[model samples]
Target: MKISSRFTVAVHVLSLISLNKNVVSTSEWIAESVNTNPVVIRRVMGKLKKAGLLDIRRGLGGATLQRNLADITLLDVYKAVEVVEDGELFQMHENPNPNCPVGANIQDVLELILFRAQDAMEVVLKEITMEELVKVLSKKIG
Candidate 1:
């Protein structure tokens, strides 16, 4: 199961911001860290800005964290990506076999399972904060 790229980018960018604080980080630099296009970085950064996690400036300007690192968690970062709706991860099937009892109930069962799983994941994510993420980055980068 692959997570969204936007979530990954947000974590990375926010981790940098958590470490550097008010120092504006360029999209180019973030792109380099992720090894992706700056355009993609900008697009994701825009979403983060809208979520109030970051402040984006134009021109040669860049971005910085808008809130305190201790106040930001992995759950907040992931929520910025979007809510984890039921069956969002599993995806409901439209063409279930009407002839089979199992097929008729698969969608409902899967939906419940997926919802629970997402909730469990969110619980774990909520425990991780930007401060923890920055510490991990520091170990890897410095």
Candidate 2:
């Protein structure tokens, strides 16, 4: 299953936003790091801003972290990027062979498994913070 780009960008965005020291970061730079469209970055930033994880300024301005990275979990970033808590993460294929009994029931079983997996993943994500990720990334990049 493919995690959305929203999750990727939000993680990076939160990490960089956490690095500022009495300074704001431009969306352009954020987008550049993301290697994506500025419009897309702005849209994601808007959601993060609304979630109180970030602060945005208008007119040649930039964004700043409104909350501490330690206080912002990966799950929080996922939420900011609009990743629903539903079982869609598994992306169960719709066309299970209807002829077989197991096939008839596979969807239900898969959905239940997906839900549980999602829950487990959410817990795991909550255990890590943007600050921790930034530290790891810094070490790796350094």
Candidate 3:
């Protein structure tokens, strides 16, 4: 399954906010930093807002981080922006050949593997916080 960049962009948006803790971050500014369109930033920001991760004032104002960076996890950002059917991170091929033995068992095997992979990913994501991200960014700039 192809993962969307919206998850990364969402993290970028939050990290920018965390980096500039003293100032409200406009979508345009964030978009410029992320090298994307402001509209795209706003759309992702909207999802984060809905997820209670951010606060965006209407028109002429900017966005603010609602929670401490240390309190937010990558998995939280993933959930905020990922639009998945049935909230699945991994997807199995649809309509595997029922006539073939490998095809018949492929999905079952895939499901077990995918479930473990998804769980592992979530565990890693949950272990990471935005605070850790900011420290890494600081190292890069300095």
Candidate 4:
């Protein structure tokens, strides 16, 4: 199964806040940019706030980054949004037939590989910070 959209949306929200530091990034305003409902933005914003990535204001005050963009990484956003449970990114089908050689051995062989894959991905994510991403975004928009 694919990872949830919440991760990307969180990144988008963070990027928007970084780019438009002067603008009040209300849930509705962020929703407009993401082409989604304000409720979705609010929900994602709530998670981001809980993760200490964002500081959401009460009422109409809107939201802002809690930490510098340079301090945030894609992995930070990934975990913040809870796209997948810790160490459970690639889930295997439950109850492989013990009688079958392939079924019995599949999980054993695949688990380590999947974990390594996930770890590798996290490594890449950790290397790239939000500030780096925003720089790419800025170049693209110009």
TM-scores vs. true structure, each candidate:
0.81, 0.78, 0.85, 0.90
Residue clash pairs of candidate 1: none
lDDT of 2 at 125: 90
lDDT of 4 at 36: 99
RMSD in angstroms, all models? 2.6, 3.0, 2.2, 1.6
lDDT tens digits, residue span 1-142, model 1: 5776788878987876566656668888878888899888888888788889888888858887888888889888888866344326656769899799999888888878888997788889999988887888789887
Candidate 4 per-residue lDDT over residues 26-85, each given as its tens digit:
988999999999999999999999999999889667898999999999999999999888
At residue 61, candidate 4 shows an lDDT of 73
Which pairs clash in model 4?
Answer: none
Better of 1 and 3 by TM-score: 3
Q: State which candidate has the highest TM-score.
A: 4
- lDDT string for model 2 (1-142, tens) is 4677888888888777776555557888888878988888899999999989988889868988888778999888887787764436666778888999988899998888878988898899999998899999989978
lDDT, candidate 3, 24-95, per-residue tens: 699988999999999999999999999999999888678998999999999888888865545677766799
Q: Give all candidates' CA lDDT scores.
A: 0.80, 0.82, 0.88, 0.92
lDDT, candidate 1, at 58: 89
